[model samples]
Target: MQPSKLRKRIGGEDDDGRHARFLQIGVPRGVLRCRRGPMDSANDSVEKKHRKVLSDLAWAMHKLPPKTYSLSVEDGAQDAFCDWAEAYWEKADQPTTKPLLAALYNKLPDHATKLSGTLHLVNEYDPDNSDQWHPSKTIPLSVIRLALAIIDCLVVEAERFHANTDDLEAQAIARFKELPPVEWTWDKFKAKCKDPIRKEGSKLWTNVVTAMRDAGIGEVTKSKPLTFRRHTDVDGHRKMSA
Candidate 1:
């Protein structure tokens, strides 16, 4: 009887080697004739397993939403990654599978750092209020710092202009990083923060001015009590006209 195609391809003229391979392995010669070579079967299986592992990791990343009060989505995502790594690390053969799982695990620390900073800002500032002036739920802390720096410049300019915040916004925006131009106003400033950062800024500004007065840093211009007006922008903005 003629040898099968797989056997002929591998064994070729080495008929002795072919019989030795066929007999050495317990798989019947008939079975070798009926099935694909072992190498081909193994390659296909590895490919399928590699794809499944990738798909599972992608799904886990997708499930992690933004963190919120009483819900640490960042923590949840970290746990998911840990679970995936533990489950697949032992089974991961470098042959067909990429080390993408390990790469993502490495990025976990960076993600945690940002989440921790945002949570601290939120908890410290808007402990009760839920408004746009709060730390943004979606915006990164770096961006928030940019906004705060811009505001500080504005306040400094406002003070320079004898507490008149009227037209100082445009000048401040021009000097700082150019965000898409919005009509400059105190209300607009509040809107930028989303709630947390703004609340914290307000608290800190008030506290500092009060502390300064207590320490007699600035003179009390208005009432009999040692009180200093932190803000002086007129109109609907948090302006205290002494």
Candidate 2:
């Protein structure tokens, strides 16, 4: 008896140019055959698994500290951590929930310590506030600072781990680093405005300078030197302006 021909389904048609179908070889003795499925389910399953692993790895790396180390989170760890963070934030502001708040508060100091200055900003600005203060309008400058620190730490960690973080995350880290630390003193503020090396013309600087001017600190000006500098002599010595 001749061996049965192995036929494959291709483009809704069979190898022999007819609609796909199962083939059977029969002999007076015995024979058997089977048809292939319309889709490659096994390949699809493998691809899905690969994507899940990559996503989990990326999330885990993002939560890690920016230091050289071999650490990994278990499957579903990211989801669990997020759920816990949500629950913690939900109870943070309730006066009666002191115990719960205490537990979560303890965790933050360690995480904050591990983060860089920028990532700490993100953590502080994490909008899931349980307080009366609105996150949109009243988040503290310290919180913003901490949240930015946290983001910076995460990006550095991602690179250290060779995790595939998105471009947006990397860009955020870059932008945060570009921001200069706030200068509350009039002299420091004026120096910042005039510093060509610091890119002080950014929108962040513009907004901050505007706010200070509105509060009567002194407006930014190109026509004349900064108020703090107007009193300085041409030789870079301090003198009262006439």
The CA lDDT of each predicted structure is 0.37, 0.37
* Candidate 1 to truth, TM: 0.15
lDDT of 2 at 136: 28
lDDT of 1 at 160: 29
Across 44-100, the per-residue lDDT of candidate 1 in tens digits comes to 899998787556544543444555623234445334434533543443444553333
State the lDDT at 104 in candidate 2: 40
What C-alpha lDDT does candidate 2 achieve relative to the native structure? 0.37
What are the TM-scores, per candidate, against the unseen true structure?
0.15, 0.16
Local error of candidate 1 at 156, Å? 46
lDDT of 1: 0.37
Question: Model 1 misses residue 107 by how many Å?
Answer: 0.8
